[model samples]
Target: MPQKKLPRLRGMDNVREDEELEQFGDSASLFVRDAININFTSAGRAELRQEMKLATDQALRCLWQSPLHKDCFAALGSYWCKVDAETWQIEQLIECGPGDVFHIVLNNMICMACDEGLFVYDGSQAKRLTIDTPAKPNATDAGDGSLPASDYSLAISWVANGLESALSEIDQVSLSKNSSINLQFPMCLDPNVSHVRVYMTEPGGGELQQAIELNIATRSVMIANLPELGRAAQFQYLSPMKTGNFLREWRGRLWAVRSNVLYFSEAMSYHLTDERYNFIQFPQRIRFIEPVDGGIWVGLADHVAFLRGQDVRSMSIERKASRAPMYGSSTLLHSDMIKELSQGGTWCAVWLAENGFVSGTAEGQLVELQYKSIKGISAESCQLVGFADRLVSVVN
Candidate 1:
């Protein structure tokens, strides 16, 4: 005896019989499964595959119809859809609403809004919206209650894109896994705030890392550590001068140089392993640091140096020369005043400053950089993450 097949739904009693969809005429019958696996005969196997296909198609339609999904679909072209665990069988396609997608985890899924505004949403409800301004808000505008009254933004990272590709199963965006929710910001120029904050939390909204705060009144400098939430972190007070400067993490060290005073903490550990109460005592203000020859590259006013283990030495003795590419004699006047540096490719990248930008390679080769004309806009605040192919930055 042949196995029985599931019945197909009719499309308003089709007058043309040939136009009707076949439930079993083509390949096989279908069955749907949630998570559990079921053993079935060859006939059942065919049905399961068909059922999976139908489920996936229906889910995609729901995702596509969503207003939230359509708004910035291009920037989020990397976005993918999956069946909602609780509403898998719901026939109506999922529409983008308050709760369609909210969180983005590395290599997991990323939820983004179409417009350049703040979107507040609960799991299923959107609470409020605020549009972003073109220019940095002035001090007077900062006092106005235009921005959301959220303190967490001070220590957060503003990722414009590439967020959806960062999530992973170890930290997925489901209800059960150790998931975390981060509000995304494209730029950080709010007059009210000094700097953005970055924190890591657990599925239940518990903090996993402590908060890192940057100073907005200063240059583009930041500590590269995601605070360890819940842990009581202690720091040996090495009174770093409050020169209104910034701290940066490189090669696993919290590095801060104030008026020639070089202060360094162990990488990730944040422990004051070594401190030269005065950095100017060594040479010039350590301009920048990089990774070279399996060691750390330290840039000074006129030389490129290296540090490995505990030994620091100058690799190039060309003092008074800029470590970065120079377009003219004036760009080198402030070799220590590097505004921005980004990896361009496996071998090249561009730099930025108030005057203009330059380019460089991993092998210490540098060149003045230029951007191919895009509309009437010029690239600024540009940073290269992977190689030269994927440039992530915004233009003024």
Candidate 2:
């Protein structure tokens, strides 16, 4: 006697009832209501989800596990925390505004983004990168050295480690007689600021050149005979990076997003941005962004917009999807594991859409798997992580 074969359900389609699903009964199901804590095996069979719980009492909003970093990072109730990657020991890195923390690696360090602002974690604590510009230096006349004095323009920038703030307002000094210009720098209150850089125009010159770099403690300096001048002011009109929730390093530039606008840091300079030229505006809120080989994938409120090219100004943008993906739902596939699943396409940005799992490629190509499998699902925030050949999506 031949045993009756039961159909294997591949996905759920609540939009279609049993009568409507009869034609596809060998593939789909009309109901999947009680599948909590259950996962589908590779063979399309359901089983209990295998999970190992990490012990921690602090409510964590988000975590970034990085191969470049020895310690993992977490957002624990308005504080950034460092967790021992192996021992899971928790240590508060620093206090920040309460919100989800997003991360990216740039300048050989971990950059964290949250509601508060953009920050980078030094080994000791989280150091904030400032957007505030230094105030213009006060220009006055001191006795001359050798050259006759004309008009002078002075500006200053604050520096902390490798980061530099925006240039201050230009202060013009007019000298009727032969005199050296005495410039007084403003007092710096931020503890992260280490020194102040002064830029001045050579005796009547229009181009502001680097005059001197002084410790924040030294309040003023009198210039007599100018020593060898440094390079011209590069960021005279540039501003520091604005606050963004999602940040990624792509194509030698750091990209960040908040609300509906996407900002990219200036070329070669990772801390400054010219908003006029280094930003893109999406019609809707950006949910997620991922770096591809030559371009990036942007998940918006109801569509996936794929931007292709090396440069931001000339990149071609194309609309990929019409449905909303769960916020923060992007799971970056490992480079080697990309070939393990059916081996057809090298998928990078895989997200949980309203329909099912969709994999996008570096070439702006998209391949969908298990379409209509998990229908009518949405979440405010979903963290998708890949582990041990398994994709885990946690909805918060």
Candidate 3:
């Protein structure tokens, strides 16, 4: 035709954008965004523990309390300060309403809870903030059995600096006897987090639920009872359940263990189906459930059992006869279960037959008891308090 001009070549004629993209595939793109390479070996376990130790040390608050000191502290409900773990020296034993506490979060804000309201403690004074309570139509005793027409007032003084500008309401849920509050504020599920759950034990001696779901993004409140509410959305017990209790959540599913149990909601296929929970009764009374690598290690007075999925197989001791009997028919003793360590340290108590009892710490320290000697231990210095080996206090 008209001297078809040789196809005009662009300046960078050889450059192929699609070819470069194909060569740098998904793996390369993913590596640039988020990459995790795990090396699994014996070294990994020790490395994990070290990382965990560093994390805990940076996050936890360490305090020391003697028996007499604790009794006086509880009696007064006062707020006091103790030495940092690094310093190992106590300081600032101030007096408050015997219920005041210094809560350290993110290694910055130290908060104090007072009757007036939740207050921010700036290592010195308590600054109170106005908090909103649920609308009580009849003002029926305001949640904690107090005859007061209003709900329990919480005063917090220290709000993490930048967070203070955003702090809307901070409520302090009281702990029942032998119970604790496991609070997850700015929860893990929602990055722009808002809601706070109040999990508490029922005054009727079971479990109770009160959800304060406020969408920080939207600033709205939603409350639902656990039994009636589906478990698909985020849900946690107001109080930690006993070693053996069944729970049905919003998403249907079934999960059980001697220590904790759950029934999942049908909406969540990833979870167990919700239905009537069944408890497995052992021929002998179960004392404790300790989780190991792949299964649960069950403790019994006479022998130990390893449970994998559903099959329960007993682990025979090389010296079974040498182990002392911990429980008798219809009677259980305090020594039957393992002793829990205080100050977030790992320690377990085990019966050693003629050896009487042995307590070992994560650090490999051993406390042994015999008929004549209670060696390698100072009971007075122990920060652990428990009944029948059920941990009660982890005093620092």
Candidate 4:
């Protein structure tokens, strides 16, 4: 008598209902039309998945867990939670309402994204990421200065801590010959602002050049003489990144995605983005962007493209044959932590795709896990959270 081997299961696929799927336990496998109330572990053991008691009346969406502390953060209907993962303790609760929210934790900084705008929580309070620009300056002809008679425009930007905000509205003024313009700037309502960077046009409509940097408390400045103008105000070509989805940090720069455009911040700077020169456009919509050791894994609409280079501008895109990734379904998994559960787990980015779960290694090699027996064909979006402790795949 021969020993009987059971049939192994590959993930579900309803698209090819008429075609026979892979069968057998070794080289091929079969798929269930639907997997209900059970999950199979890596050793091919089917464990019962039961519904447990809810801690809260409602559910938490867009959940993110911190690896260092093992705590979790989630968004309730209109609130935010700081939870202890092991004990499931709601340590802190915040009231942040009315829009879809996404959370990101970079080092000590934890930021939340919503329809209203972007905000950062400093372990206590969540503050919106905005700094008011100093208002247009009021100009008068009643001044004794070296400013010659010329029509000029003055632009100013606010600086909080070391972050320089977007340039303010330009205020134009006509100066009579030998007469100076006395400019007075209104007090900025944003308390975080500490300094103001001002730029002015030269006589006879010259280029806007760096004029002077004054403390925010200094309301008035007499344009006595234009000293050697510093560097040109090239920052005028840039804008602040107020809101974006898929916010990620890569190579000392902030990367965000909107539509089909991937916008990048200045090196080591987060607030400012030069969209004209600091963006990568794709024909298809971007689902996720994950920064890896030597490159990035970009999940596009219907394919997965690996960018193979440290420099984003020069990175080469290598598209492979694979099922499309679901929207916003990517999560970071550590090799050491994953090794406890399964095999061949490296420090790579994992995302749910139409076929199954796709993992992109830092070396730009792609390995897909298609034996999960989950149907991703009909799912428009999937929720992947707490991958370190437990893999929660909620098809939405």
Candidate 5:
């Protein structure tokens, strides 16, 4: 057979395959590479001329920036190393055991949840906050009324006909104070009592009434815009249900979640108790919860919910009746996969979805970023971290 003359290829467009034409379609500034490292410029452009390489061969599991130490922490394999922000040098901090998860940072303390226990690191030392075995409280003696009270105590007494009755003990108490008071209790307290009563007392006349306006929890109580009660304010220790798996501080309150239940402590309180905190149940397991804008964003197995209210006591499952469902059957990978970044002046939460990636705003807006380049990549193999002006995603 005679050879037929073929047209000379002039450019990529002339020789492009059907898939390449569909993916790159008429775009001049688009580029794709199997492995390419690029730097983001101050002018908001990706400078692809320079390439970089990883210092280690281990897979990167998680990445976090510590404002206290001015460095970045990277969890690779079973080891956590600190990357110096100025020199970009990596220093191994500790070798974590299997199933160890780094939770959050509060008060310059790094919190981690592991199979062993809850650990907190204060820059230099790591200590586990032990959840002691709950002790059983003995029945009150009928005659003597002598019970060794906890390090904290709360009592109430009634006065009638100018006669004062003996004070009766209560589990929880809320008091009004003009100044900020720190309520401290033993880390290990009996977990039997569930509810505590708070009383607002008039300092001058010794008049007391049940405090309905004050926010009190098992670990702390916050009283605002009220006069000092001197020595009249008191509280007794009480045990609440077991703590949840995930903990985060949001809107002046501590939020904990386990399975499908979400619990929030009282305003400005860190104590997690049934009486001091309220819980909302969701249809699916809550995978992530984080503070966004001025409220909270909860990521469930199949949906996302936003919570913003003045009082945590009033938050219920009914408030989440309008949750936005995820695309198809996609779900979040892990709680730590969610990252909140500032886009323009508003805050946006980005997470790794089972399909690709998704972003949501505090205003109940969700956008799925299923770019053609990342469409079919396994979600578990993708890790995302937000820097000052850019989002870096690594695929293994």
Candidate 6:
């Protein structure tokens, strides 16, 4: 056949797939899987490099900026250390076990939960919180136990006896004038027999006396007319049957979650009393609870929820519909994954999901960043930390 002039191909822009592809350039931001390095002035995508190195042999568990020391604290396998000017300074704050999990920060201290018990650590020292519990009655003793437990009054007394055994002591509990104290039990307490006893020490080495106007309830106690300035006040109440796994401070209150129940401490006080605290139950097992934006983001076993102003709303990514109480994708998130669940900015928070990464804004918008180039990145294996303008994620 006679030779015909062929049209010249300007560039390989239309080649979507190529086996022999080499150099590529585009004005749009490109996501890639492989790592590369280009000229600093060139607008090309490149793999992230390690900006700073941590000096430690043990695996790093968590990192946070300490407001007191004005440095970063790294929680390694068995101990924690302070990182300043890129130098890892080991600190013997607390001996953490395998199951130990750092909970939250309050009053310039960090709270940790471990198999032994709950512990609090300042920059210099660590103290294990004493869990006050009343003596358990002997089950075999049958004086009142032999009587029929059917009469209403007798039933009430029996309940009181049971509560006496379950009483938990509140240590170092203090209150201000006209303020209330909230107590959180490990489990719900019986309102019939549960009551709070507040012991206040008078000024100048005076005797300790119980305060009045106590409002007792199932899980909390409220005491009004607290002395303005007493030597100190202590509280005791029925012990909680269970201890919470996580603790955080939000909206002027201390929050703790055990299983599906959420407990709130009295406003502006850390004391959890039967009359002072409130609770909310969820349908599914709670995986994580964090304060995001001005509200709280609750990650359930299958989905996520948002609580704001006494109202709770479920979030899903499937529903693109606007004007809903919560706005987000309906993608199923991995509940067990606990990495980078914190605020990314003033308006948004970042967290890991089953498939990829996600971010939720204060306006109730959830976004998924699942670029194919970064598909191999596992959120579960990464520890995320936020800085002024960037987020640093360390992968295992």
Tens-place lDDT per residue, model 5, 1-396, is: 999532221212323344553332243232233333555354435556545566555555555666566556665566665656566566765565554254566657776544444455667655443223222221121222222222222343322222222234432322232233232322323232333333444433344455422212344444333333444432123222234545666676566676788876544434324444367777887766756663566777556677664456564222343233332222222223344333455655666554446666655456665433343344333445554444555654
User: Would you give me the overall lDDT of model 2?
Assistant: 0.77
lDDT, candidates in the order shown: 0.31, 0.77, 0.29, 0.72, 0.46, 0.44
Sorted on lDDT, highest at the top, how do the candidates line up? 2, 4, 5, 6, 1, 3
Query: Could you give candidate 6's per-residue lDDT for residues 241-303 as a string of tens digits?
Result: 223655666766666677788776544434333433367778866655666544666666556
Q: Write candidate 4's Cα lDDT for 1-396 as tens digits.
A: 999655665544554553465563336656556667877666655678767776654466666765545567877667777766566666545566765577666547686666655667777766656455456677667566777777888888888867777676778888777777777887788777888888888876667888888898988877777656788776675677646678777888777777788878777666677667888888899988888886888888889888789886787889967688888888777655544234355578888887677777778877776634444464777777763366676878
Q: Write the per-residue lDDT of candidate 1 for residues 1-396, one digit (tens) a residue.
A: 999556533212122244333446665333332213233343334223223334333423213222333221111222323334344533221233332232221112223232222222323433222212222211111232222222221223321221101111112122222222332333445333444333334323533343443343443323222244543222222321221122334454444444444555443433233344423234665544443333444445544444443323333322323333111111111222233444432423233422234443444555443322111223322222221222323333
Query: Model 5 reaches what TM-score against the true structure?
Result: 0.52
Question: Candidates sorted by TM-score, descending order?
Answer: 2, 4, 5, 6, 1, 3
Lowest summed lDDT over 10 consecutive residues: which window, candidate 3?
237-246
What's the TM-score of every candidate structure?
Answer: 0.25, 0.87, 0.24, 0.76, 0.52, 0.52
Off by over 4 Å in 6: 1-30, 33-54, 71-89, 129-246, 257-263, 271-279, 310-345, 369-382, 394-396
> Any runs in candidate 2 off by more than 4 Å, and if so which?
1-34, 51-54, 85-88, 334-347
Give model 4's TM-score versus the native structure. 0.76
Off by over 4 Å in 3: 1-193, 196-213, 216-289, 310-322, 325-351, 355-396
Estimate candidate 3's alpha-carbon lDDT, on a 0 to 1 scale: 0.29
Candidate 1 Cα deviation (angstroms), residue 389:
5.9
User: Which RMSD values do the candidates have, in order?
Assistant: 26.2, 3.5, 26.4, 5.0, 12.2, 13.5
Worst-scoring 10-residue span by lDDT in model 2:
25-34
Q: Ten consecutive residues with minimal summed lDDT in candidate 1?
A: 161-170
Residue 350's lDDT within candidate 4 is 85
By TM-score, the best candidate is: 2
